[model samples]
Target: MRLSPGARERLTIFWMLFPTFLVIVGFYIYPTLYNLELSFTDITLLKLRKGGDWVGLANYWEFLRSSSFFDIALNTVFWLTAVSVTCRMILGLLFALLLNASFLKRMKLSTLARLILLVPWATPPVVAVIAWRWMFDPTHGAINSWLLSTGLISDPIAFVSNLSTVWPAINTIIVWNTTPLVAISLLAALQTVPQELNEAASIDGATKFQEFRFITLPYLIPTLSVLTLMSVIWTFNNFVYVWLATGAGPGTFTNVLATEVYLKAFVDLRIGYSAAIGVTMAVVMALFGALYFRLFGVGDMQEKVG
Candidate 1:
């Protein structure tokens, strides 16, 4: 079959985008291949300055045996599950549902609410992290001062300083910042839902919970699944919160894969080992994303069939 004249014109338009394609290939693909090559070599700051030797998988094997690997892996898992699953997607969906309500729709107040909600998202993550770090400060911090004024506690809590609380504190800021995007995506989906369906259910004496359980939820599931998968990737890659908040300290509690990769490659000057860790993080995120899509697609298929 031959392309139509219209199709040929469209193809010409696409060809005009060749420069952008070349730019992506040059900057992204070329550097990615270079990084992969660098991973297999005994590349270092000193070596780069003086040329280096090939070291096979020695760097990878060393990373595998390193003590911090397991801890960082677990921390990444916690960050992904806690922030992406429980906070970002779940809370975003709830907030979206609330904002999608008919009352809110009529008043146009949802717009104001959404704008306010996006403040964290609009601001730079580094700025947000720094602001949050100060807010969580032990003494003279806003949170501590308020707690003391209200007699909520006798002492200022070491929110970010303590290893145990570090995970939650970092996650809180990430969730606060990222949830708005998720909420906005979900809100758009929710708005496309027909008002008549809910009205019909209500007239049929269906309770609020019943209407939401059957009508609203089924529609949101597909969108929610995609958002959740994306959130997992973003949260797993989150470095700013942990990096700026606790500096991957109280020894190891807050050291996620991204932060650990930076610490290893830049701080420890183990380029090859850090690349191995980077590859591991990429693999884990890819696997999780695949699983998420597969399971959600399966469920969606079953729903459609039934």
Candidate 2:
């Protein structure tokens, strides 16, 4: 059957989107495929626009053989699973719940609290790193000063220089820096919850904890899942905070996959091997995404993504 004039007009509207599609295909899709192909070959920083001898899995093998590869991988996984998801979820939920409370309705007070929380978010990554690094300094830092003043410790502690404390320090900066975004998203979800449900729960003699567990928690699960996935990916790929704050110091104890890739590619000039690390990080993120989708159902996650 022949299309009507209105249908053709609608098709013309869709045709207007073709340019965006073309741009995405050319810049995003094509570059991704090129990167994948480059990962398979013995490409180097020197071979920018030329052919490289195919090396199959040699690059990956080389990466696996690196002394610090497993350490970096374990650090990445730990940060992604524990620091990123755990801290963001807990703090986001705490602030979201607090802000949604009826007693915090004074606009000036609310604004001040929100502004303070947003400081870490608004600060540039490099600047934040510098600030955090200074704070963690053993001798002259504010942290040690406060600890000494409060008698929490007898002497200054080298937060970054200590391998055991370095990851926690790095993760503290990351969690503080990124928690505002998650809090805002979760607060929006909280606001959308029906007041009637909460009121009814209260009238039925439900305690605040009970009400949250039965009413609020269920509604927040899907949003929390999406936020958790995002935090996981972002934390796994977190480089600036760890790199600048600690420089992955004490012999690279805090180096995650992203910083490892950077050190390999730029510092060591191992482009292909770094690309393999990049691919590995992507695969881990994809696995997390798959698990999230499976737990929540693909349609639900797609709805959020779309």
Candidate 3:
């Protein structure tokens, strides 16, 4: 039987997308479903060779009842909020504005300045964390040595070893690594704003702050909204810096949900419990993404990108 033109077009499109659909199902959907099934069981490393009995929701219940769960959840929320708000949004906007300024365009060193700012972002996460760990070392770290030489501190401060300092030290590294990407994205968004809008605001005798508030900021809202959500999701799920830097140690002071999941899965060998944690993380992220779409409207972002 011969198909109509529209049906034939759709058939061709489906064939084109068939490979990609198969890949997504094989890698993503299948793994997710398997993980969910595992989460409902009492599977562990020992039971991997032999199948385990399904004890429905046991892993989830145990995780929820555990004393460390609340603290880990709170730490996760704090980490996500602080990093996304300060580094990705606030400082990012400030740096983007500085780079986009007309005065900076005339400076010979502006390009060099931008490149230097991006160095941290370009560095590998593990490499960056290792370098920062050295810098924060108590005995002979560069930061301590410099501070002592400058008479800033009489003794070395244990930045990563101490409970109070560990989170802040890790956060600093994360911010430095992430800020450049945010700044670059915002800079691109800034370039899309029409020059006429700013000029009109200026001709109306508006102050620099006023011009930005009235013209530049309005244009940036959609981009900022989308970026903010992405930053939050990325920061929340980030495991490298926290794990490599401190390994969620110093008595669980810095253990976020991601690190907790890692520890449970690999260190404790409780695969089922870890899968439950993974599922929880996925659900929270999905809900947040859905709410963001509902409140801000995804079309605005698509239009801005176009």
The top-ranked prediction according to lDDT is: 3
Model 1 TM-score is 0.88
> Can you write out model 1's per-residue Cα lDDT over 1-306, one digit (the tens) per residue?
899999999999899999999999999888877777777877775566774578888877887788877877777886635554677788888888877777986997978888887887898889988898889898768988999889999988899887667778888888888888888989987877788999999999999999989998878777777676667777778787788888888777778888888987888887776777777777777787778657768667456334
Candidate 1: deviation at residue 268, Å?
A: 1.2
What TM-score do all the candidates reach, one by one?
0.88, 0.90, 0.95
**Which residue pairs show backbone clashes in model 2?**
none
Identify the runs in model 1 with alpha carbons over 4 angstroms from their true place: 1-21, 105-108, 298-306
lDDT of each: 0.80, 0.81, 0.86
Best-to-worst TM-score order: 3, 2, 1
> Using lDDT as the measure, what is the rank order of every candidate, best first?
3, 2, 1
> For residue 181, what is the lDDT in candidate 3?
86
Per-residue alpha-carbon lDDT of model 2 for 1-306, expressed as tens digits? 888999999999889989999999999888878877878887777786786778988888888898887788787787534766697789988987877766777554776677787888898888877888899899889999999999999988899898777878877877788888888888888987898998999999999899899999888887888888777777777778777876666777777788888887888877877888888777878897888789888888787655
Model 3 agreement with the true structure over 1-306: per-residue lDDT tens digits = 999999999999999999999999999999999999989888888889886679898888888899998889888887645554566688889999988877888876679879987999999999999999999998879999999999999989999888777878988888888888888888988998899887888888999999888888998887788788888888888899888989897778889889998998898988888999999999999998889887877786677556
Which model, 1 or 2, shows the larger TM-score?
Answer: 2
* Per-candidate RMSD, Å: 4.0, 2.6, 1.6
| Per-structure clash totals for the candidates | 0, 0, 0
